[model samples]
Target: MKKIALLLFPFILFTFSTFAQSANEDWISLFDGESFDGWEAAENPETFSIEDGKIAVHGPRAHLFYMGAAENHDFDDFVFKADVMTTPGSNSGIFFHTQYQEEGWPAHGYEAQVNNSFDADPRRTASLYNVDDNTEVIFPDDEWFTMTIQVEGQHITIMVNDEVITDYTEPEDVDRGTNVLSSGTFALQGHDPDSKVYFKNIKVKPL
Candidate 1:
């Protein structure tokens, strides 16, 4: 019996390793810390910068988007995540299923609110902007926290620090005005001149 068990051990270990590798491959990074090689900014490109291996936002309105050639910057059902840190009174957002424009707030896609202590906005991090707003303060500003967005079909889930903040299901007949839920790329918001936010480890797994 001992000899038989030893013979199967290698197969079991190899199976586990293979599963781990497959899982790791599902998540593809969209940002390179040193530069914006895979990303581009809207009008005011100067609002974005690289500091301490992170994308820093601290200027007038602008949006940094993933235009990488890897995925063609197009996505529909997917899981997106990033490590975010906001200074006091800062406001920002994570826009998914969105396209790029020369300027102005993205008229398409969904926005995950990233305001922690900004006095102007009550909807805190992981809130799906106006769709499903979240007001409870789960995390503080100036601290690194993980914000995740998962979209499967018409359902959407938003999480912060692994805590679910919003779970929404779009109705078939819902009206989105000019903003429509369709396949697109990802973007990071530089809300205003007063708001300062940082993002790192931006990655996505298309479903």
Candidate 2:
């Protein structure tokens, strides 16, 4: 038993070291948890606020875009992640490959639906909104959950709680006008005044 433990110690240490190095080297936190230094809001700019050390989305229609120094807020292939919590009947979304719009819903990129129990929208959390809409409720409301969106080339994948929910591949002839897949920054949506959502640990890694 002592010999086996000694042999495994080196492997365990090496594994941990690799993980730490990879995370530090690749991932970048988009939110500072205390300020919006790297983020910019559109339309109802007041729709987002830092409360309890998390982004509080509690106002009318608005989109908050990432416009900081990281990659100049421009990403072609990357993984965007955040911890989110939605109140009952709330609606929100995370947009990737989207640019900042002065007003109204984002006109670019794709929306990974952050809705779990919103009675108004049939799309559930982690849905590739419209394009690959999901109606299954995979996670519950009022709880912290991790959502990740990975884009590589023409393929897009969305996960909730580290579980795959939506896997989309943009076709060669596919065209949805401004909503088509393209390289751009990320955005957070404040769906409506009635919906309240929380987001934290926002991060991304360019690939």
Candidate 3:
């Protein structure tokens, strides 16, 4: 009986360890369904808000930001996934490695373009915006679309709804304006007036 109990103890310990690791490995939800506890606005708290279990970008021309101060969780190599929906002709973006600037847009960062309209320009959505990297069309506006960005070192790839869009590597010694590609905070853009955007299911895993 003593020998059998000793053997079972190891098995029980192993099972508990496995279960704990699995729970921690799961994706962390950035937004709580009830409140914006882990976020903040770029300029003012009035710009961004939580509405009906989703982060809503209101106003027509204000650049509202979701503050990421809880972890200061900067990533060097990781995979980011989010579900996004926007109004027609609305122009916004997902900014990464962004630094705050006073009274203007964040000068330092890269924007994952988010625009969806038949008349919308190619650079309007899913394009690397001024960085000159273009990907095939894979935007499903008027509904929810999954946007995934994978960054490994200097190489970055973006996929919209399982469709590969921008896949390019940063040129060595090239200037990235104010946008620091290696590491910084992540944010959602609120461009111009009347532009409403919704973001949900945002999760990130380190590479």
Report the number of the highest-lDDT candidate. Answer: 2
Clashing pairs in 3: 40-67, 60-192, 60-193, 60-194, 61-192, 61-193, 108-178, 108-179, 109-179
Query: For residues 1-207, could you state the per-residue lDDT of candidate 3 as single tens digits?
Result: 999999999999999999999866765566766776755565544556777777777664445444554346565677788889977767778877665543467776788888776245567567877785463445656798898887888888888887878887887887756664767667777776566788888777767
Give the TM-score ranking, best first: 1, 2, 3
Candidate 3 residue runs with Cα over 4 Å from true position: 1-26, 64-71, 118-122, 133-137
Q: How does each model score on lDDT?
A: 0.91, 0.92, 0.71
For lDDT, candidate 1 versus 2, the one ahead is: 2
Q: In angstroms, what RMSD does candidate 2 have relative to the true structure?
A: 2.4
Q: Which prediction has more favorable lDDT, 1 or 3?
A: 1
RMSD of candidate 3 to the truth, in angstroms, is 4.3
RMSD of each: 1.1, 2.4, 4.3
Taking all chains together, each candidate's TM-score versus the true structure is 0.96, 0.92, 0.79
Top model number, TM-score? 1
Worst 10-residue lDDT window, candidate 3: 62-71
Question: What lDDT score is found at residue 96 in candidate 2?
Answer: 89
User: What lDDT is obtained when candidate 3 is compared to the true structure?
Assistant: 0.71
